[model samples]
Target: MPLQPLLALTNSEPEEVECPAPAPAPSRPLTAEEYFSEQPPEGDIGRPRHLATKVQKFKATLWLCEDYPLQLQEQIMPILDLMASMSSPHFAKLKDFIQMQLPAGFPVKIEIPLFHVLNARITFGNIFGTETPVPHVQSIEEGDRISAVIDDACFAIPPGYKDATALDDRHCGLDDEEGLLQYAIQQSLMESGTQDDQVDVWEALRGARPVTPSPRSASPNLLNSEERQLQRAIEASLASLSVGPQQAAPAPPPIEDDLQAALALSAQEHSRLESELMEEQRALDEAIRLSLLDK
Candidate 1:
């Protein structure tokens, strides 16, 4: 569906990046072809990337939570849906965010909370596309830095939401958001079913849970009853993996001149890759440009 960017009016969150609604209006999320294709749609303005959050220290753990002004969850949900439809090299930020867990020495955690959007507006022509270098998707390093900023913001609970009394008296406002973030994290950990004493909140946080690999035959059987069937299955699988043509290897005991020839071949290979890389970069740029277009 077309996504509308909400504007924050009051001094609620520290810093928020809100996109201006495009002309003709986007009624749905950008298609993968559009998101990755060349040229922005007719009206897309740009994707805004800004860091905004609030922090609080409750007992031993430090809560690192975003103060989102949009009740629609514009920060993460749309990106997630886009990720579910695309592959590698696209929507990589969402992928990396899912894998990020709080590290030791910081006593940090992540939670989602909300605020209100007082009003909204639309900006004229795409400000970014007209520029020499229109903005592109963030790199892994840039994404990591933003993640770190969200994690490190907690020096202390903001002015009021410190003691239990503050929490008890909380209402549906900014302070409530802060408490909600902390409470959400606590609830998640409690639901994990770890014994209360076992989970020292200050200890290093957990990483994504590991997935079990499917079982494979540990040892091949030569004379078992199913040996014939196993051999046929293996042969069929191998046949399906036949690759395209490849250069034959040189003789094992290669001569000095042969090595020199191989070096020349390697140099030629590098030159070919360099050309391919330039084309790829050009295509990537076009894709980013078009992604700014309205869906």
Candidate 2:
């Protein structure tokens, strides 16, 4: 049996049936192959999107202290970030933060009072790339402070802040024998009577240059008044010997009586005797007078 539509009192004929459009088709979920194969969507292409990686160049300051407990490399990253945020004028104010961060129990007896700030400029192809040598890191003198770089690291240490062990490790004591010898030679050379020639030996022995004695330390070998007089007298005696006409030749050693008898003197000695010659001449003259008378 067909069912009749119910109508309202004032409503016209039964409301015409409203037909809905067919439902839209559902989208297919993307498969792995489709997602991977899809090309990137194009947009405005005025400039290239991929840029060359920037070359990293930056300056950093590092420090080394004698009693500083922490390795400087550990502090660099944080200190760098904090300092970079402030204006250039604010760097001096950061020293307090630096002092606070140092490890406790560090023996900081001789605080050199100033930080050695090693300013380093570094460049990199990548943060972990090979480290190339810096072209030239200028040496800057900032008031009582200086900065320097030593192979792989650049850092500063205070002027008087020597490592506690440096003296202990390197020192060797004074040389006893050498010291005593040097002292003796120095004493001898300093005496007033040391000769000028001896001065050279003393100086050579002590590894010193020959120098003229100062008035304060004049050598004793220099002639004083009395010494000068003695020197003059000796010089005069030598001169007298050299100047004498027919100075007697040095006498030979005396001949022993037994040796003299073995080698008797020749007639040459008799002729040289003045007494013997006079006797012979007188006898010859007497004979000549007697002969004349006889004639």
Each prediction's RMSD to truth: 33.5, 38.7
Maximum-TM-score candidate: 2
Off by over 4 Å in 1: 1-256
How do the residues 247-293 of candidate 2 rate in per-residue lDDT, one tens digit apiece? 75343235434322221221123225657889899999999999999
Candidate 2, residue 198: CA error in Å?
Answer: 18
Instruction: Summarize candidate 1's per-residue lDDT along 190-260 as a digit string, tens digits.
Output: 43643142322223244333232211111224123223433343343344445445733323232234332
C-alpha RMSD of candidate 1: 33.5
Q: What is the C-alpha lDDT of each candidate?
A: 0.38, 0.38
Clashing pairs in 2: 192-220, 192-221, 193-220
lDDT of model number 2: 0.38
